[model samples]
Target: MDFNGKCFWITGAASGMGKSLSLLLASFNTQLILSDRDVKGLSQVADKAIALGARVLTLPLDMSDSGSIRKAVSGVLTNVKRIDGLYQFAGISQRSLIIDTPLENDRKIMEVNFFGVIELAKALLPHMIDQGGGQMAVTSSLVGKFGFPYRSAYSASKHALHGYFESLRTENSLNNIRVSILIPGRIQTNISLFALDKDGKEHGKMDPGQANGITAEKAARQILKGLRKEKKEIHVGGKELLMLYIRRFFPALFYYISSRIKPV
Candidate 1:
């Protein structure tokens, strides 16, 4: 689990939690493949990693497009001997009532958040397996564990990641492949502003709960610790941590209360 000298391929490395993780991993002296659709932002990440004495590669990527993913992965493989770990953090969030949510927007969320992660993992997993071991970490959400109003599509996509990655872990345990699903309740990130609405426009608004959540740096550190321990599931944020326990022991009551909790 030591990152020193290992190659890491991380999506969404431009900012927020992804950027925090990139910085932390660099401090471990890992070779980094930083990817995102923003070339400028990715360049910034690469520069910082280089300054931290880590080998760095910058890749412009569009997670929703499989063709782009294939090309990016191929490019990374050509530049590096192997990927010791892959963190699937590139995703979009949605915040429209299900009945009013545009079907196209919902599909786009699923494409980027679920299918994109799955396809990329499928492509990279063989290399990890061939090496006889590796790690794949996915970012899910608190909504993935339980549905929330105005985020129906997002909830579904994140829930799907949990099921898929958990199964992959079961199937690949003998190969020493570790899968960690991180459920972050509400981190202070651009997620809310970038969340899509029915018209495919940014929500441009904050949910109070999320706005007051943990900082991305703290969340990333906890995530790295969990991945090092090879935990199957990790929930960050105090509110989400409490909810995790409630969901486990009081499913019906939790569902009833959670369903009634409205967005601020």
Candidate 2:
């Protein structure tokens, strides 16, 4: 669908693919509601969107906090007539083995990555239905479809997204509410640097695979294309895209290969 004159809300708008998407959508003449816990970063992105001649709203949102999400959703409902699109991109990653990872870290990852997206979507579903239809895009990972090393909780959270949104899609088809799960491989972003460790501390270093991955801008463009096509699931990346098929057609081989590959 045409994005011109439409209103889209994006979480994790402070940096990475979300910021890139905001700028790209600005060029398409869309109204953008950008939210993130980083107020200063969000403002910087808003200013850039404003400079690009897009109507922009910046709101503070902490995905781990239900109160913060409720307040942000309230603000959106108060100001915007309808949400044309929702992009759930606020998430943290993990770089530690599940055996060593703390229970709190798993909960934190699930809170931000899975529950946060669900809460916001549930809150907005009624409005979307009232408006006749809307699209929701979620940023999942390659691991969401197939497990990999050092990403047990992260993978589990993303896997939950696939199941939840797929069910939502089936149930909401009559309402015209569409769900698109964007599964990205390794995109060159700072997600790795801020990834949680075994103790919940930051990883503080970028993964080699991520550093060698595609740029966030390219990923955003691909995502937009998939959304426009109304695809149910879109996979974007380099060689990692092959993994999806391998896991599907050759599960035993994929398991052998994946076991040998070091994620970090």
Candidate 3:
């Protein structure tokens, strides 16, 4: 419960759930290293956190670029001696049907949502192991559990996180590194608005489901509590999360309903 002096590094901290979590932790006397490609937005979040009493550092990161990830990791190590946790909240969404999407779009989605995620975790693994132990949590979507319309590539990328991080967790049973995969239904973020289209342009529309979801702050509170308990998979959201159970327990009914839901 008391997080005073603990250090947490979060990506995609410029907006949405990452920014919400950053601000929430600020009141706990925690040290935060926030990263995002939006340098201006990251600065604004950092400034706000400073106002809230957290020791904060801002790093510019581009999830689609390996060089940017490396530079940011180096910066964190240079300034912060320890990371109690590394929360990977950076990802991109897709809004085109598989038939309309190009192969290039799939690659682009993987590069950011999958490669960028594992690269950061791989880079920090040694340090975390050497320092005794640390926790790693990655933000995943509800589609990560099963297929959904207009999210072919996006779902694949999130699905990949489950395989990679689950293996990482089992492999590090002795190393003491804990990995938590966050499966969120919807959290009122701009993910849908910024989703990539078939031609790689932003969809630029607010999804009705996204607009009706819980606030990022509420999602963050659930996440923080789950991470504190070191839960293996933290599910966040409202009744929308029932999909996970339906997919697991009532596969036939799930298919029937999922096929009828309109993708906004």
TM-score, one value per model = 0.96, 0.98, 0.98
In lDDT terms, how accurate is model 1? 0.88
Over 1-264, each residue of candidate 2 has an lDDT whose tens digit, in order, gives 688889999999999999988888988778999999889999999999989989999989999999999999999999999999998888999999988988999999999999999999999999999999999999899999877789999999999999999999999999999999999999998999999999789999988888999999998899889888999998877887998999999999998998799756
TM value for model 2? 0.98
Candidate 2: segments with Cα more than 4 A from true spot: none
Error of 3 at 171 (Å): 0.4
User: Cα miss at 57, model 3 (Å)?
Assistant: 0.8
Off by over 4 Å in 1: none
Q: Please give, for residues 116-169, the per-residue lDDT of candidate 1 as tens digits.
A: 999999998898999889999999998898888888999999999988998999
When 1 and 2 are scored with TM-score, the better candidate is 2
Q: Residue 99 CA error for candidate 2 (Å)? A: 1.3
Q: Where does candidate 2 clash, by residue pair?
A: none
Which pairs of residues have clashing backbones in candidate 3? none
